[model samples]
Target: MEKKQRMSRRSEQMGDQIEERIVTGVYPPGMRLDETELASGFGVSRTPVREALIQLASAGLVEIRPRRGAIVAEIGQHRLYEMFEVMAELEAMCGRLAARRITESEQRALVAAHQACEAARDANDPDAYYQRNERFHHLIYAASHNVFLEEQAAALHRRLRPYRRLQLRVRDRMGTSFSEHAGIVEAILAQDGELAATRIRTHVVVQGQRFADLIASLPMLGSPSLT
Candidate 1:
């Protein structure tokens, strides 16, 4: 059982790495993902690579075909916009509920997560900030005390992870993101549900110039890849 669990975890980690590469244009859309190559790159067996590919396929990041093996899927910009719109609303709901329901312990944890994000931002490390940022948002979701809502939010959050990480790579985005997180933390701590909701919505929703920036940063479909 322990060995099986370890394999599962390895597969999940492999899937995450593959997802990151795809989102960052290292593995562009429609690029063939050979299991043996992936396994060799990660220094793992083909079994975990295959399992990871399956997981990515389920997430719509990779498509599995009879003869084509696993290929990266081309996610349309419009569809991404739609997903972000829904994500904004879901995060807003989580923020609102968290403000009303958060306990002292959860609040402390949330603050700690924010502080970690601050450290990452100060260091000018987008990758570090991205990981800490995820923790900060997750703490709020847990503080909401709504299991169903938390589950839904987490699911969408996972699907949008690649885009969110990419967004963080934009110039000065890490600092801006950390600043927005400060406002969110303040509202939740103040127990101002409406303000928390509004702040979180604004933080998550890409609009106007922000949307344009994200679209411009996206890797072009069918781009050449060395992988």
Candidate 2:
């Protein structure tokens, strides 16, 4: 059991390293991940590397083929737009519901999450801000007090995490995200459901555009050719 637990931890760490590279453009979309090379690079046996690749595949970040091994999954422009549209509407619904039903405690948690994001921004750490930003949105989802809605929103949020993180690389995006968060918090605090819904939708939809711009600007992808 102990040995198995250690192997699990190693695989998780290896998976995180690979996922970080994919998210940060180190391993851009459509790049093939060679298992033998990964094993050597990670200084581990092939087993852990294979396990990590499988985990990444399940997250939709990597695709596994019988002959081709694992390659990073590409988010085409049309599919990207569709996902963002759905994400925007889902978040808008959460915001509207949260505004109508948030308890005082939940409201405080939302404020704390926003403050955490602000701290990350002040520190000039986009990675940290991204982590806090998810917490902020999740808090709002929970505040909605709708189990089904929260589950759906959380699942979609996880799927979109990588692209969303990439958006933070856009110039001054962290600052802009924080400003948008301020508006969202204000509307929610005031119990203005419509305004909250609108603000959240705009915030999410704008992120979709920022993500597109980031992809287009990447020297590696070279003109956002959707695969």
Candidate 3:
């Protein structure tokens, strides 16, 4: 690959690593991003780090201030709630469509994802469960067959990743999430469009609530200043 392609690939990989850290709450929200520090951390140059920041900014995952610096995006309760509202509608639509359009292969994939989550939960592995849970949701999104809805829901999911991970950080949450997913799969399997829609919406709304609860009990989440 040419130097340009190499840089692009490196920037993309660095961006994915940074985004994963952000979503996993390792970076947390509202934290300042020092380009030099990030560059050193990744054994790269400031250019790639800057490029990654720009990519994250475009995704609403970070904010680049004019001279202040780049920082993880701060989110308010209202904004979080708004995201849930929009996401719930999108996921509800996906569930309704999926109930009507899901294929046998998709169903089996969903089931396997669910089983993986259950196994992770049984092992008391929050991190592993979160990964499988994401795969399970993505399977449903794909099964819906609405490209626009899939894209929209995926964007929302990306934004909510850190918060969702926080909720799962609570003790026994893996089990709870696994149960919720199981019910969601059952609703989809029965071809109960309305039921699936309602359940999926409630599932997401509950996520928002769980996030709020996590912040309330921990307080570390909402207190991170974008400095």
Candidate 4:
């Protein structure tokens, strides 16, 4: 059981790494993902690599064809926008519920996550900030005290992870994001459900200049390569 659990955790980590590479254009859209190569690259057995690819497929970040094996999935801008739209609403709901239902311990945890994000921002490290930012948002989801809603929010969060990380690379976005997070944390901690919902929704929804910036920064799609 312990060995199985360890493999599962490794596969999850592999999935996250592969998804990052895909989003960052290391594994461009349409690139064939060879299990053996990936296994070697990640220093694992083919079993975990296959498992990772399968998980990515389930998240719609990878497509597994009958004979073609696995290939990176290309998400068009419009489709991505739609996904973010839904994500914003889902997160808003979480914020609203969290404000109403969060326990004292959860509130402390949320603050800690926010502080971690602040450290990452102060250091001007987008990669570190991105990871901490995920934890911050996830704490809100868990604090909502709704298992089903938490599950839905988490699933969509995974699907949008790459784009969200890319957005952080925009100039001064880390500072802006941290400021927005400040508002969100304040409202939630104050137990203001409506205010928390509004703040979180505004923070999440990419609009106008932000949308343009994200699209402009997207890694250029290229021909598939078996890397």
Candidate 5:
């Protein structure tokens, strides 16, 4: 079990590095990732590197071809918008359910998570805020007290993590995201399901605008690697 956990952590770290490169356009679209090269660069064995690529493929960040190895996934504009749309609805549902079903303990946990996000935001750390942002949403999903719903939310959240992380790179996005969290938390705490739903839906969907800012700021948008 310990060995498995270690391997899992290593794979996750490798995936994070590769995902960062892709998001920042260092790797760009259609950049074929050689497992051996990545392993050597990261000072790891190919085993973990291969595992990481597989994980990335599942997250929609990479595509694995029979003879081509792994390359970044070329997600189209329409598909990207569709994904954000679904993500908004999922988050809104979580918030709505959490507002009506959250226990006192869960509420406290949510507050703590929000506070952590605030700390991360105030420190001007996008990476830290991203981590806390995850915790904040996870707490709400847990508050929903529906195992299936939480699982669904988690799966999609994992798939969208890279895109969401990129949006945080937009100018002053962390501050705005933090402010949005304030409204979301307030609505949930007040047991206003309708308000929570609306606030969270808007908050998630706002990433679309952030994506636009990111594209505009960058020299060029990366192309998708079609398998």
Candidate 6:
């Protein structure tokens, strides 16, 4: 493969690893990411690690400073609220369109996705539930059948990854989140476009606020990466 292709592939792999680490809480927000350390761990050169960091930055995963290097971007309460508003709108749009355009197969997949989430919750596995919850939303995006909307929603989703995981930190959130997912599916199954949209929007926004509150209640939430 050409150098560019090699670099692209490395970036993709590194990006996925970084995302997993962040989502699994291995690397918390505002935590400095040492490129040299990553490079050694990946058995690659710092050049590729630098490229991966840049990729993460573009995905809103990290921020590069003048001399301090790259650190995971901290989701502040203000940005968290703004991201929630945007995500709620995006999810609402998806729900509205999916109600009109969702195929039988896609609808089945949505049901299965939610069921998987419920199973994870019942098993008391926050890790599994968190993963499935992500898929559930992504399945909704696929059902919508709007390329632009899917891309926008996906980008926003990437940006909100940290907070999304932290949402599960709320007390009894597994059951509560599962209930919210049930409501969303109920609206979709009924083909209630307006209701589906409204419910999903409220669900997303409330989760966003809840995440913000969770962080605020934390004794120490690292430090601000951007500000």
Q: Pick the candidate with the highest TM-score.
A: 5
Query: Tens digits of per-residue lDDT for model 2 on 1-227?
Result: 99999999999889878988887679988899999999999899999999999988977789998899999887666666677789999999999999999999998989999999999999999889998999999999998889999999988887777677778878898999999999999999999999999999999974445766865644333223564
Poorest lDDT segment (10 consecutive residues) of candidate 2:
218-227
Q: Pick the candidate with the highest lDDT.
A: 4
Tens-place lDDT digits, model 3, residues 43-124: 9899989998898887777889988799887655566666767888888899999999999999999899999999989888
Clashes of each: 0, 0, 0, 0, 1, 0
Q: If ranked by TM-score, best first, what sequence of candidates would result?
A: 5, 1, 4, 2, 3, 6
Q: Local error of candidate 6 at 22, Å?
A: 6.4
Full-model lDDT for every candidate:
0.89, 0.86, 0.81, 0.91, 0.86, 0.81
Model 1 whole-model lDDT (C-alpha atoms):
0.89
Q: For model 1, what is the error of residue 58's alpha carbon versus the real structure, in angstroms, after optimal superposition?
A: 3.0
Task: Write one digit per residue (lDDT tens) for candidate 5, span 1-227.
Answer: 99999999999999999888887778877889999999999999999999999999988889999899998767665566667788889889999999999999998988899999999988988999999999999898888888998998888899888778778878788999999999999999999999999999999974555757755543314443312
Q: Compared to the true structure, candidate 1 yields what TM-score? A: 0.91
Evaluation by lDDT, superior candidate among 4 and 5 = 4
The TM-scores, one per candidate, come to 0.91, 0.84, 0.81, 0.90, 0.92, 0.78
> What is the Cα-based lDDT of residue 199 in candidate 3?
87
- Evaluated at residue 117, the lDDT of candidate 3 is 90
lDDT of 1 at 223: 27
Cα error, residue 165 of model 4, in Å, equals 1.3
Q: Per-residue alpha-carbon lDDT of model 1 for 5-124, expressed as tens digits?
A: 999999999998988888778899889999998899899999989999998887778899999899999877777878899999999999999999999999999999999999999998
TM-score of 6: 0.78
Model 3 misplaced regions, further than 4 Å: 1-31, 67-69, 207-211, 217-227
- Which scores better on TM-score, 5 or 6? 5
Tens digit per residue, CA lDDT, model 4, 95-137: 9999999999999999999999999999999999999999999
* Residue 190 Cα positional deviation in candidate 5, in Å, after optimal superposition: 0.9
